[model samples]
Target: MQETPFCLRVGHLLPYSMSDSNTTDFTNPSNFILIGIPGLEIAHVWISIAFCTMYAIAILGNFTILFIVKIEPSLHEPMYYFLCMLAVSDLALSTSTLPKTLSIFWFNSREIDFSACLTQMYFIHCFSAMESGIFVAMALDRYVAICDPLRHSTILTNHVVAKISLAVVLRGCVLVLPTAFLARQWPYCRTNIIPHTYCEHIAVVKLACNDTRVSSYYGLFVVFFVTGLDMLFIAVSYTQILRAIFSLPTKDTRLKTFGTCGSHLCVILAFYIPGLFSFLMQLFGHNVALHFHVLMANIYLLVPPMLNPIIYGVRTRQIRDRLLRLFPHKRI
Candidate 1:
């Protein structure tokens, strides 16, 4: 033995580093403790307040839209159907991360079981991926409605909508399951503290004793194909949408036609911009601060879910119309 830097004594409960470095041994279950907004542990109490507010609004807003879409017959068209799917995806994404995040920030409860962490990681990525797919699907819906008005109903019928939803859900589940499975199989000999608000796949994988490049690269690949391709296709769809608008005979017609896409366009940009930035930072800026990395990651994951419902409530006419019709009007 050249020199023993960190020693794991037979009965010690905590690991300590005395100055040695070596490969880790991967065996057995390891509990991961999430560190929220790294280097700002003192401010977690305040952070939790903001997060709770976002969560409350996100869940309530999304649930409201879901309720409205479910009961209203007039809004049972394909666009609203896609919107409902979007709401479901947002709810899944938020619920997967926010509750545990609040627990970490408010109660200092961050110890996550190995299996539980794996499950959380799986859902986070899965729901996020699903959300991306839904955006693409929405863009396609708009393209059809705008570019081929007469065929829109025929194309996006109930059967077709159900198939699209199934495809979105299945795509995410199939893609993310492998990463979670491979991650769970990795040997985590030490370093179970995840430097983030939630159990993200890459963050959790870094704790493993084995070489983590495989998971990292695979994660990057999935992101490129899933989120990246979705974005590319959205861009292409919108390009066609713009052409269709310009082809309209009158200016008012063009504006009215494009207005229908505004909410979806906002949602697409909102979701993907931060995601792209976070992913890029991870790829190229290895020297970036851990706190910044964690912050960006949290913003990308949480902001869209919190904001999507609000955007739709304010922007979509059908939703707003139905919402106003929900209450009894008594002029005081």
Candidate 2:
């Protein structure tokens, strides 16, 4: 009988085996679970299919949004400029995790290199921050258009829009880079199996053997500082916008103004509400809650991107007109 290889024997013990020819087993036992979710094998296949579809749609939808904004001279205003930024951010956000996630599903391999994992996490945070900033900018743009229409063009001139874009990029860099730096300092003694489909900062941080208290605190601070503050500003802006709209002499003007903002409000709520619920579920409920949290995570990340173009096209006449013009023969 031929002797069994030591590497093969070792690989059997690890949750995930290295793909390299050297055959070194880099498996951490603590990270191994017995695939605890019932019917997880079938669930994995379904999840893979679902994620692949979502990933493809996300890429295509965002790309179309970007293309429309770029080619259409009519969309050169600050609002469309910021819409393009949001599209870019959404593309980056989805791309950061979906490809790798699809690979794991198809290949039955979850062995991501340390550096690759870190890179994915960094971009995930960065693009998410960027999207939040873009939403805030959108609210501000609406405020100016409604509350200070006389100076809308002056206040949000090309130069000013460019400056705001630069500021959003800079803020994303500053806020998200620290997460990568802090994550790198910790030793990943625990199992490297990330539970979720993506390289989420919180999920990965939970696997660190070292103290992640600081990282968690920083993440919370970011969530509160960026999301919390942005939401507050958006609320105030919308409140003032509502007051202005109601005070308008013509009902048509009021309705048009509300129509313009309605889609954005819907998208914002869709993106934030599921995410917040998932976060709360994860924090409060440990066992069964995790499963629901994971499901919500997928919806939160994918649904907004999928719905954004539809929402804007359906809600805004200009966007609908452009879409129709782009496909002139197609009937609505």
Q: Candidate 1 on 29-83: residue-level lDDT in tens? A: 5577676886677888887787788888989999999999998999899888888
Among these predictions, the greatest lDDT belongs to: 1
TM-score of candidate 1 to 2 decimals: 0.91
Kindly list the per-residue Cα lDDT of model 2 for residues 31-102, writing each as its tens digit. Answer: 322121122445777777777787787778778777877788888899989988888887777777677666
Estimated TM-score per prediction?
A: 0.91, 0.86
149 Cα displacement, candidate 2 (Å): 1.1
The models' CA-based lDDT, in order, is 0.83, 0.73
Q: Residue pairs in steric clash, candidate 1? A: 5-20
lDDT of 1 at 305: 87
- State in Å the error of residue 45, model 2: 2.1
